[model samples]
Target: MGAPSTELQELIELLNSENPRIIQPACEYFSGLSGTVDGLNFIIAQEDIFKQLMKFCSFENSDIALLALKTITNCAQNENGTYFYMACDKQHFCTKSLFKSFENGDERIIKSSILLIENITRIEAGARHVHAFIEDSKLLESLLKIFVSNKPQYQDLSLIFGNICQVPGVRKLFLKNEGEIFNKMLPFLSHQNASCRLGAANCVKNCCFETDYHQWMLKDDSILAAILLPLAGAEELTDEENDSLPIDVQYLPSDKERESVSDIIVALVQALHKLCSTQMGRDALRKYNVYVILRELDKATIERDGNENMTFEIHNVIQILIGDDAAECDDLNKLEVPPEIEKKLTEMENA
Candidate 1:
């Protein structure tokens, strides 16, 4: 009855079938689509579709139901977050209906709550209202399960945890009372999934302002080599290996690293470039061999950023290090890229 797509309708119809083949692909397709909540809310408003999804969330067939659950959540939480929050707060509407998704023996419903709550938090000043849920402490247990859940739960949980960790009081609770929380999520930094690692990294970065997160990260075995290695040295990069960093460390034309995620990489380059241009981060970079990573990253930007703002920023970094004329050894003493490396960089500029 709502504005409809054949794909959405097709997935909805296929949900009625008991065939595993139909349900599996249907779940995949459902997960892949980001439909308007109007369409999903309209469909759920119907008695039949609501009942079917509820059944799937039950112990009967959670695998299929989890797919529709996230889809519905995505719609409700999309740009119309305020609308959904207002509606959910109403007793008989989406809020009541959503809470019903959580039930005994229903892992899918429980898991889907991560996305739904995340959307709720996006409302203007809406996080304050959602924090009321955390006040109950019941959500904390569910949150931990979702945070640590494997497979499909990983990204969703990381997102929800990321948001939860942002609330000022909530973060303190985890750090002060639940000391093990951040450490539990450390392994996620090296997750095979880039988005997962990126999300987890941002989460860890937040913890840096509290306690000993940066020092802790420096020592953690899982994160140290994978992340710190490139930042610590100018080693060769394979196509796959280079794809890993937020920056393209390979620095070559036609290299193939692609993502629509992790804006933090750009943020890191910009931040480090600024930090390095200063007497402090520059001194730290030189003393710690961090300049090699910056130099290679700068070379990559020569073509990728092409004298763009990012290039100008790196220029500041280079200027500070070599004193605009390779006349300083004070800062370079800490950085060990060798004179030959500097000569090669100068040659590239002239060429």
Candidate 2:
């Protein structure tokens, strides 16, 4: 009825890293065969498959075996009269085996363990199940310790933190005290490594999901302002007439350095116009000369043929705060545009 149990026995033989290339091919070939009871039974029956898989887990070589394990667990972890992962009601074999792996395993097992537990927890048949054997308080404490630990830098930490960020409940567990984990992660926002900053941003993004983080990012003129400071030295080094100097030779600091801190200023204003559109956002935006910025940005989003999507959202914010445009200037494009304030004047024309 099935491709003789030899295929299953062969896959189990391929589970160890000593076998090397066999693991992935074994997974691919066995993936199609996992649902068969004869195959799964043979896989579990094979000598040393479980122990080698558990040991190989920490090595990058273990990813395929872990995936295969997760796949087999999912196929076997059903409910309903159907012969699937439903072993929960009929028996606890499938879910219990997964929890045992999580209980008596290293971090290599966490990847599949967390996934299998979440799947079991969310199962229609296992609705009443207490799937997460690791308590939130303990897990958050453990994860935070890793964030500040002096241990080796493993990419696995990034993947784990990234995964935690997606689950709302897990995130609350990580950030419940506000000052607890946040103070630790704050410095990494500008760490020398780009991945650390990106990971920190991702963590911030998750934490500030319900709050207005962009507002917070802009609250201190320092953050965005910082990006422009270096860009100034960039302009002088540009070779217009000749290859005058390297891009931004570090000249002695001067009063002109202040001007260097400045940009078209219109560039960021333009980005913000596309961003802040609601009443609260507009009010928070008004903290800076946000209206003038939006006016400048609206001028920029315009096309050769006409204006862009900003007319509606930008104008909506303008209308809510300042009232309708005066009867004479309601439709802005009709106004004569001056070349000097050509961009600013287009605001009226585009409106």
Candidate 3:
């Protein structure tokens, strides 16, 4: 693309002006220009403009920092702009600054940074670049610290970490920290915030995709109970049990929030289904009495059946958990030798 206009150049200069009054409007104007990919690409072509954004990303003024982040978030939304940002990010300076914002910037900056990182991770090249920076900076551990503190942004961090785990090598690293990650996430399984609970469930589902995690999960009854609690709804958690719950259980939903409530239920069930593959996992399901919860939920759905596929998935998981024939889960039993090869005639019978 051709050069950015003189007006764009003036606006870029104003972002660096001493006055926050000038910087805020300038950042807003740039963010507006970034509404379309072609507009963002044209702006990205202006290397000075891109570098200025990286500077303002760490502005002492919170409003400037947030606005700059918004502009970057808009740019990060386009794949071409994402590639350009990662490509032009020399010595990993921009990545480091962004993580710094996550660490110290106010709520707006933290949330915007999470969105920017999420947008970047959606592109494979961008994800790999982020993985490399995080590996060098020990950023995962830093995020884990923030998570342990239970900041409100922990919900965003959980979702961001879940997205990062989609990268293969990064997933392996997360698997190493599985215990700590699970310890933090499990409580959120019962969190009052619907988004927090949903993010936790999604992270649990992705982490459990590994065989090693499945083995660990099967052995942890506490986790098994925690995973089933949301799907089982209020009935599984008594008033006495709710009083001592790890987090305050959300009060039953009103009419307006019913859809959000349903979405969280689906997420929890999906996470449970990820656990039903192995015999050990199935045993754990029964040990935790997951079948009872799922059966009740399935029956309720059947009586009021609106969503067919979700009901089918929940039903399927219950069957696998309760099925008598091990062959029903043959896919999970594949490590063993085939029956014909393992079978041998007794010598006495042969005689």
**Evaluated with TM-score, which candidate comes out highest?**
3
Candidate 1: tens digits of C-alpha lDDT, residues 119-225: 76554345555555455555665656655667564366665555555566655555554446666655665566655655555555444434333333333233333
Ten consecutive residues with minimal summed lDDT in candidate 1?
224-233
TM-score, one value per model: 0.49, 0.40, 0.71
RMSD over all Cα atoms, model 2? 13.8
**Runs of candidate 3 exceeding 4 Å displacement:** 1-24, 35-48, 78-84, 103-105, 122-127, 136-138, 153-155, 235-263, 299-309, 322-351
Per-candidate Cα lDDT values, in order, are 0.51, 0.43, 0.68
Native-to-model Cα distance after best TM-score fit, residue 272 in candidate 1, in Å? 6.8
| True lDDT of residue 17, candidate 1 | 82
Better of 1 and 2 by lDDT: 1
lDDT for each residue of candidate 2 in 156-269, tens digit (9 for 90 to 100): 343344334555554565455643664455555444444444445445445544233345545554433332232232223213311221222233244433211112222223
- Please, what are the lDDT tens digits per residue for candidate 3 over residues 1-351? 454487766776796688888878877777777887677877777777777877788788887777777778888888877887887785778778878877674788777777788778766678788888888436687787786677777556666665666566665676665566556777876777666676677667766666557787666567766776566544444455444332323233332122236555676776777677666676666665677667767765655545655666677678777778465553463546566654542222233
Q: Could you give me the TM-score of model 2 versus the true structure?
A: 0.40
Clashing pairs in 1: 286-334, 286-335, 287-334
